[model samples]
Target: MDILDQLGAVREGKLSRRKFTKGLLAAGVAMTTVPLPARRAMASEGEQATYFTWGGYDIPELFGPYQEQNGTLPNFAIFGGSEEALTKMRGGFVVDVSHPCNQSMPRWVQTGLFQPIDTARVANWGDVIPELVDLPGNGAEAGKVWMAPFDWGQTSITYRTDLVELEGEESWDILWDPRYAGRLGSLASGGDAWWCGAIKAGIDFANIDTPEAFDKIAAVMREQRPLMRLYTDDTTTLEQALSAGEMVASMTWNSSAVLLQAEGIPVKFARPKEGALTWVCGVMIHKDAPNLDRAYDVIDSLLSVETGHFMINDWGYGHSNSKAFDQFEEETLAGLGLSKNPVEILNAGHFQQPQTQEWETQMNELFEQIKAGF
Candidate 1:
């Protein structure tokens, strides 16, 4: 069915909302179009906690445990990117929980809008991956932390294997190749693109805070800007563009490539020679959580093995629960670009380092200017 038809089905209650949203995403709808007010699960809306997150994450499969216990999934508010989500929460749009990745963790904490997660409250706390949970600046006290690690993965190029005529081995330079101008796409958010720029500029991530690194990355980004046909935070737009041969390549998370591949599209999530930008992202509770207990339940549910399995097999992300890997063999994991040893994959890439809020602002502003053709 067409997107309009699927949307109509959702409105008529003839289709599940999750299916409608999933169809929209696969059909290339921009994520920014998701309404700002939270979309509550049809049943038990009043008692549900609100989960603010990225577009693909609000589906019901991830909330299995919470639904079994509470009889409904938490209300969901979608954002195109983490920085946008943080901006909304900063404007006093309180949610029970909001998702952010490692690169922005410290800055989120600095905002003083969130409370640390009490490990004791989470049922899956023990099985959660240590390396994922031990992100820098996320520590709260003896046994708590700011974020409960959930999905972890890379931000890298996903290109059409059949269409992108490679001049050499996969690398970050492919995005800047003049031959592909007006046929390439990229994520607009600095959270992904600017870091990839840091790689393309050959700046060491440890010293990424330096003024020199900033200038170099900015220069590299500006040079690549004109080559991009589209700059979007929505995977749908990128996926549709690639699937239809409208775009030959794009910067994307693992899911886009995986989803396209499932449809028998020949694509590769590039293992850029420099390194893919990698990080761990999870859930953070609000300081004034209206449904405090349910918020913890939401975090625990995401950390569960059930959710972990879905995240890995379906989303092409690494889940925090260790046992989630047991169901799949080394070969299956390898096929998906994942491993039981997440730290191995994480360390193999350019793992994101926490930066001060000021640095994030400056970097994003610089990126916006470049995207604006400045």
Candidate 2:
């Protein structure tokens, strides 16, 4: 069945119950019927742009200041992965903006689901770090800026500090450590597993389209399967499991470790010797955005130094605007698990690359097999 059909069935309740249950293990959907007054208020005050992003990225605390300045919150929605978000938007859900990881940008652009930004309208465009703004290379030529970068960080091991010991730099080898078999928590779906496996195989992330890389990663996924406790996408649940000692350690985004530390959970996030997987998540505009001007306002507000501080400390990710770091004190910046020396830190990082469709299909099959306890 088509991915869109799968999503439509999810909305209509016509798919297999098991698949639906598995989908629940994927992304959370927050939607509602808006009254006419609310809709009118959005048009008059600010465009009610719905952001489809990770759970922490859409926090009330994070957006409160933006709301104070603009008078209305960007109506928000959350999701577990970029693939799931794209599936919903293409399945007929309309939202003015979305947050997609860098790896998904090529696919999202090719599908023409998003429109490039009118850079003139975004006031804070000058503050975005050049490297992040040019993520896809010469983005201006692509007709519209496909992304307005927000947060970036590595995918590393988040382990129970009291349980695991490392003799050297953190490596992908830790997830396969047999000592913690049956008590590990791994993300069940989405593109994370593929990225993790690639680092373990030492494949070049940006050029991983060959059959050789695929075979090596498939073997790695199979080897790690039995050690997993639950195939989950919820970071909150994953953190709870880690805190309770249900999972000794597992592959997770940097934000998970930040949240754990904030809650006083004994967890440590590491950047391994083989290089940690790096991914960037940013806001996107719909091709036919109903309120383009207001959408730009929300983007500018999010990129502001004040919002960047909250995002770094609370959302547990590095901001795309270089100056966002200026908003933090020396110690507060360190708390986000980012090194002051960016070049040194990025040397231990590798990006998640956009896969060709064939590769994605094979990857999904391998992921399903692993989750089934193969």
TM-scores for candidates 1 onward, in order? 0.92, 0.82
- Residue-by-residue lDDT tens digits, candidate 2, 166-211: 7687667778889889878776564887777878877887657777
Model 1 per-residue lDDT tens digits across residues 49-93:
999998867767798899888877788888988888989988989
Off by over 4 Å in 2: 1-47, 142-144, 329-335, 339-344
Task: Tell me how candidate 1 scores on lDDT.
Answer: 0.86
Misplaced by over 4 Å in model 1 are 1-46
RMSD of each: 3.0, 9.1
Q: What TM-score number comes out for model 1?
A: 0.92
Clashes of each: 0, 3
The candidate scoring highest on lDDT is: 1
